[model samples]
Target: MGNTVIEKIIQAHTADEVAPGRIVWMDLDIRSARDFGGPNVVKNYEREYAGLPLADKSKTYFTFDLCAPACTLKYADNQQACRDFARRNGVEVYDVDSGVGTHVLMEGGLARANGTVVGTDSHMNILGAIGAFGQGMGDVDVTFAFRTGRTWFEVPESVRVVLKGTFKKPTSAKDLTLYLLKVLGTKKIALRSAEFTGPAVAGLSLAGRLTLCSMVTEMAGIIGFIPECGAEARKEIESYTKTPYSPFSPDGDAGYAETIEVDVQGLSPQVAAPPSPTNVKPAVELRGTKIDSGFIGSCTNGRFEDFAEAARLLIGRKVKKGIMLKIVPATRRVYKELLARGILQDLFEAGAIVVNPGCGGCAEGHVGLTGKGEVQISTGNRNFAGKQGKGQTYLASPAVVAASCILGHIAGPEDL
Candidate 1:
């Protein structure tokens, strides 16, 4: 039988049996832990091998993006523990100033196309944007990988997802993602691998693909792969690999558990209401829903394009008097680019607050949170109750969040 994207990567990484439902030990190209569960991983590793050397210390990493700069005393101590452990073990830590761990891996080319990576971040599968096999595992699983540089994984069922529309003005990749969330929901995609195909994936930029694959976890799926990389993305990938970039493609007759089709034509801006990411509806339907706060950054949608698009809406307009808008860049690189373009100045003049680059506010440990009984329209993924704050958080695209900041209510940029 033919192989899918996930199957091809599995074959490349392992010498064991390869088939759906088969569990085997595969080599990992990169292993990492974030500030959130990094302390636990350290504890586990020491208990197992106190005086032993790591299997591949050079390939291991720790990212301090979650609650970076130590939001609480416990977090501060935890981060310090990781730093000390990394020092003793000779592993590297990406420090508080570094951006999200997922972004760090790809930007550094540590997780390359057609490779395997495992990390503590649930959204580590975001690496699928570059055609890598990535998974999120518990601290114990990571500890073993730290010791041996390999982990057990079940070859998941592959699902073919055909997207059938092109994006128009004011309608974005996030909307395309939400539209899929509404159509595919959880049951259809849960526990399976989805390979995005069709017109939408043909000309998608790296940023847009990142946004599209970042949310696979919300719907309970395995990695979301966009196997086709644009020329610019290939150049960036090859820059770190120091070689030509050759991508993986599924076989023409690849075996799939199912084939699902999603049509984004005539789709309006979509927003996931409170309590569930799959609980989505059109943005216009929720118009005039009052909001007290706004946020425009997350690993999913915190690229330079996201910020620049928001700046386009805020250039000549000031944020509403009673509302607070927070802008955070995902990486120091993106933050520097924003400064070079004076995007921060435009946002500042519009009464918006620009914070340092990192995974800001999405974890509820940093800024951009809402209070009791308040309402917020955010660009971050997942609006589960109390995830962002006690107040309700409605998930939308960057354009919608920027427009809402100006009107102090749920709004879109198209009619602005």
Candidate 2:
């Protein structure tokens, strides 16, 4: 049998092979619920399929910090329901109020040996970063997970994203993925996996790679994967995957539905315009387009590296007049780290508002939102309609976000 992560998991369950979109009963190793996805799962379990009974309640996991402090009342109620549901059903709830993003919590401390995780959020695909075949589902599928401990799935075709060149500075994994999304089109890779490979991909940090894999859903991917257990992956493995995990890669003869090659050398900061992640253009193309807001936080780019880069650029500079920029670190730990390092003060001194650590302003339902007709540039993952409010949103790299916040317009790091 092949030792690839996906293959291993599939074979472990030994379910019938079926085409994509077909339902088959297979064991699901892990199932995740969060503020956004949990309520629906609970409601569906309580209403639609009343008393179907889960295979193993302990196998189900819940995280309360899905887009925290900035959440709406509906989300708040959903979170409470999730907690109540977990307690009532004997499922373990990880990080009750710690504010860790769902995927981060899973990779950091929730998912266990040779597991499969399904969550309501699309980015749950990020678990694949650690050699798991994670998938995102809607409330309906989640209800199924709660009922049977497993659900059905169509085997998705794979798209090989072979990186051939070293990524240039300011071209982090987030940028590379956005660049790929532009190349692939938003719906082009719908219901498929982008199996990342090549020397270039192997060289990136695990955190960087995770960010790339997490956003696959924005392009409508079923999931994303990179060969696991490299020196680069050791950092994550040390903290998450124990038990001598052997990484997996596709065989030379492995079948793939498509292959897309990209040369990332000299790839500068890129941006995704309003309404779609695939609507991309270079940051340089955005020069002089005035912005009313600049934000630097989200599951996609709210890491320590991202904040450090933003601080480096905004250390002594003040945000441009009429601009309201905010930083919402993805988790409480990141918030404390920045506070301890005094980066939070620097950001405040630079005229940026540092909101509570959560999914707030990034999703348009929180402390900072662009007013009507306002224009904002952000380091968030998506810019779908109504995201960040009824305004124009441009999704850019952290460097671009910092620089644009400083200049009050779309500008590159050098331009700042």
Candidate 3:
């Protein structure tokens, strides 16, 4: 049988035949660690490698995203450790304000089609949006990758998901992804790679594809790839790369462990209820659920397009009295673009708190952490308790977050 997209990439990187379940050491194009576990990686590297030089310092990097700006002393020290290591080794550091590492890597062109990148961030697989192979591992593994310029991976069995029909107005890629979570469930995709194709995905925008792949981690997937990533994504990849970058595609006769289809004809805005990303349902069904705060940012939905959707509802409207709405762009580039478009001023006038570009509201101690007993609707993935704070986090699209911010409850765009 012909190979899947991951298999083909692996073969090229390793120069060896690959199959599902096989383990191979693939040369890495980029290696990184974010602030959260980055210190551990530095410690491991120093302890294990001692005075040995890295295989290639140019490919090494440190991204400060999670808890960026050093919310606490411990985090501050951790970030400093990573910076010190990068300074001594001549490794690049996408510092505190740079944004989410995954987005930063993509924006900088280090993560491109058919390339392999490994990092400490669990959401690194979000790079698959552009057809790259990105994986997240523990600090020890990352240290090894830093020193050797390679990492071993177990080829995952691949699944073919065929999406039929188009999204109606008001529904978005975030909604479609939540619908997938509701139908496919984590059990179905756990440890397996999924290749998305079909009419529904053909004309999807680059931001939409990024939204879809960013949530694969929530689906318990190894990676979720949207191959044939259109001209927009290709242009972005080509603009950053020194060499020609062709997105990887599966062979026509590629063997899939499972094949499934999703009809998105009537899909609507969706939400993952408090405490779990998998507990997804139509947002309409949960309308009126009271929310203390609303957050419109994260690697998943913190791009310019995501905020633009929210701006449509907030430009002339005010956040409900007593409700706190937080707006955070994914990267400094996204933040600057919004400023240039006047979206930033409009958001501020709407009574929203627009913070620096980074992973806001996505984890504990981040920009929008909820207080005890509070209920929040956010664009970030993962609602697991204690991750976003002691209070509950409900995941939804930027449109939903905007509407809910104005209405004081969980709501859909139509509610406005």
Give the least accurate 10-residue stretch of model 3, judged by summed lDDT: 228-237
| Clashing pairs for predicted structure model 3, backbone only | none
Better of 2 and 3 by TM-score: 3
How far does residue 211 in candidate 2 sit from its true spot (Å)?
2.2
Q: Write one digit per residue (lDDT tens) for candidate 3, span 229-300.
A: 666656656766656767778999998999998898878889999778889999988999999999998989
lDDT of 1 by residue, 349-409 (tens): 9999898877887785567687889898888888888877789999899999999999999
Which clashing pairs does model 2 show? 20-154, 21-154
Which stretches of candidate 3 lie above 4 Å from their native place? 242-245
Roughly what TM-score does model 2 have, to 2 decimal places? 0.90
Please give the CA lDDT of all the candidate structures. Answer: 0.88, 0.73, 0.88
Over 1-416, each residue of candidate 2 has an lDDT whose tens digit, in order, gives 22334554665674676434445566887777777767888988889766566778877877665556425677667777888878888887754345545545544655543567787767777767766777778888888887788786666766777777775676777778788888877666677767787765776666677678778878888777887346756665556554555646666666566778877766777889888888988877868898888888776777667888888899978888888888877777778889999999988898888877665565444454777898888877778878667988888877888889888889888886
Task: Write down the lDDT that model 3 would get.
Answer: 0.88
Q: Which regions in candidate 2 have their CA more than 4 angstroms from the true location?
A: 1-5, 18-23, 48-53, 70-72, 94-96, 112-114, 228-233, 242-245, 362-368
- TM-score per model over all chains: 0.97, 0.90, 0.97
Model 1 lDDT on a 0 to 1 scale = 0.88
**Candidate with better TM-score, 1 vs 2:** 1
The backbone clash count of each candidate, in order, is 0, 2, 0
